[model samples]
Target: MTILCYHSVDPAWESPLAMRPGEFADHAAWLARHRTVVPLSEAVNRLDRRGRLPRGMAALTFDDGFAGVLEHALPEVQRHRLPTTIFLVAQTLTDEGLDAWWVRTPPPWPLATLTVEEVLHLRDLGVDLQSHSWAHQDLPELDEDRCERDLRQSREFLEDLLHGPVPFLAYPRGLHDDGVRRAARRAGYSHAFALPEGPERVDEYAVPRVGIHRGNNTRTLWVKSQPRYLDARHARRHVARTGRRLLKIG
Candidate 1:
């Protein structure tokens, strides 16, 4: 099974990493055309079922709980009758001033963010809301206590907001060490997502994901779905690392 991860979809440009609204719609349409798009829950449940998923079995997932998800992306997803999972940073669901990192970059664009109310609204729309963290920070970089707070508090807060168990988690910046993964399990998440270099199988703890970045077009997406393509990608990484080491020795 392939789990595709996205950040934001907006008309107004903010970062190169984000997808434009039209581009995102096109990706969704492509999935609808070629694959059996399933809900994260169903995919998890049917992991052991052999040959059940067709050639193009893909699941949609969005991280960072951007407002564009509720504003623009959800409608397109609903139109296609596709299920999506969104991981939210509990602290970002506010209209407060930009965080410190935003100061280092260009002035704040009118980036839409999911407010607490908007999250509730999306839940009503049948979107699965899960925890990203209290603040979008790299868990591996944080101490154990801080990691526990981010994971535990975020899940607790969202569960209270949605009035049920939040079963999924996407690590911020795709950063997780062994300790971070253990922290997530302890925090009550049934599964977690990582930016896998290739396609994913059914694993509750370390589900691999393919990131859809700004440069990803239809051809690139197709290429990424192939297992051989993943093998070649890994091989290229190996070659690059070997060359870097050789140069250092020289």
Candidate 2:
């Protein structure tokens, strides 16, 4: 199954992570035309059972719970009537927008995140809400205790607010290690996501996603939507990591 990841959908913000509304609409329409867009939960279920999705099936996910998603992306999503998921920074629901590393002083636009009201509204609209950690910290950099704490707190906060289970997690920056994955499982997440270049040996915790950036057109997205794209990319990353480790030992 192909899982697509997006960060922000805004016209004014020129960040590569931000795709213009029209472009995102085009992308959404294209997916509606070409692929069987499934809910992330269904896709995860298939992945768990068969370890892959059937051909032409895709899942949509937006990371960080950006306000732009509600403002811009939701209309296109609703128009297409697609099942979508947004992995939110649990703290961002109660606080201001994300405090990210990529933003400069006085960012080009406000790094606005979704509010509690907005999140509840999204949930009501059938958008699946999951954890993106508490502070969007890189999990691999943190020790096991801190990593587990972050994941546990994130899931707990979302569950308390939504009054339901939030069993999925997407690692911040798509970064994780064995310890981090173990923490995710310990924190009660049934599945977790990482980027294309994340670890090989795929399982629920190491599930890979193709990121949708501003530069991705229909053709690029088509390439990404291919079922084997992530597997090939993961294999290459695994090889490179292994080679570097060997060189260091040699």
Candidate 3:
């Protein structure tokens, strides 16, 4: 399954994470023509089975519940009738400011998050909303107790808001470790996503995803979506790790 990840789809800010609305529409249009884009749960379930999906099977996932996703991205997704998942930072989803912790204090242009009402609207529109975390803090950086608490609390908050089992988690910043994965499983998430690269991923809890960034247009996305490219990326990463070990590079 090619689980493609996206963040904000807006024209307001140009970020590595931000893909312009038209660009996203182009990507979605291509997927409609060429791929079997399923919901995140379906993708995870098929992944658990390790069964072969239809030709060009892909899934669309978004990290951080950006307002632009509802405003811009969903229209394209709706036009294509693609099943999509948006992982929400619970605190941001509920906050008056409606922005992530880091984005609240920062530096760049203001980061936008989905309003509580918009989140409910998304649910009404049949978009699957799940957990990112209570806040967008990096999971691995926290202690185990804090980590588990964060994961559990995030799931709880989302379930409370959406009134459904928040069973899936996409690790904030795509950051996770063995300890964090253990915590996620303990916290009752059936699946967890990471930016790991490879077929031989660490475990089911650390499912890898290919990120879609501002630089990726239709052609680049198709290239990145191919198995050979993903396999080659994994091969290169393995070689790099081996070299680092041999050279004692920290």
Kindly report which residue pairs in candidate 1 clash with one another: none
For model 1, the superposed segments whose C-alpha errors exceed 4 Å read 46-54, 94-110, 197-203, 227-229, 242-250
Q: How much lDDT does each candidate structure score?
A: 0.71, 0.83, 0.80
lDDT of 3 by residue, 1-250 (tens): 4788898788867666778888999999999999899888888767533322344788889988988898899999999999999999888866554456544223276667888899999999999999988887888899888999999998998899999888999888677887898899999999898865434454568876778887689998997777555567778877786454321000
Q: Where is the poorest 10-residue window by lDDT in model 2?
A: 241-250
Error of 3 at 55 (Å): 3.7
- Candidate 3 error regions (>4 Å): 48-54, 95-98, 103-107, 197-200, 241-250
Query: Which of the two candidates, 2 or 3, achieves a greater lDDT against the reference?
Result: 2
RMSD of candidate 1 to the true fold?
5.0
Prediction 2 TM-score vs. true: 0.89
Find the 10 residues in a row with the least total lDDT in model 1. 97-106
Which regions in candidate 2 have their CA more than 4 angstroms from the true location?
48-51, 95-98, 101-106, 235-250
Q: Which candidate order results from sorting by TM-score in descending order?
A: 2, 3, 1
Pairs in clash, predicted candidate 3: none
TM-score of each: 0.84, 0.89, 0.89
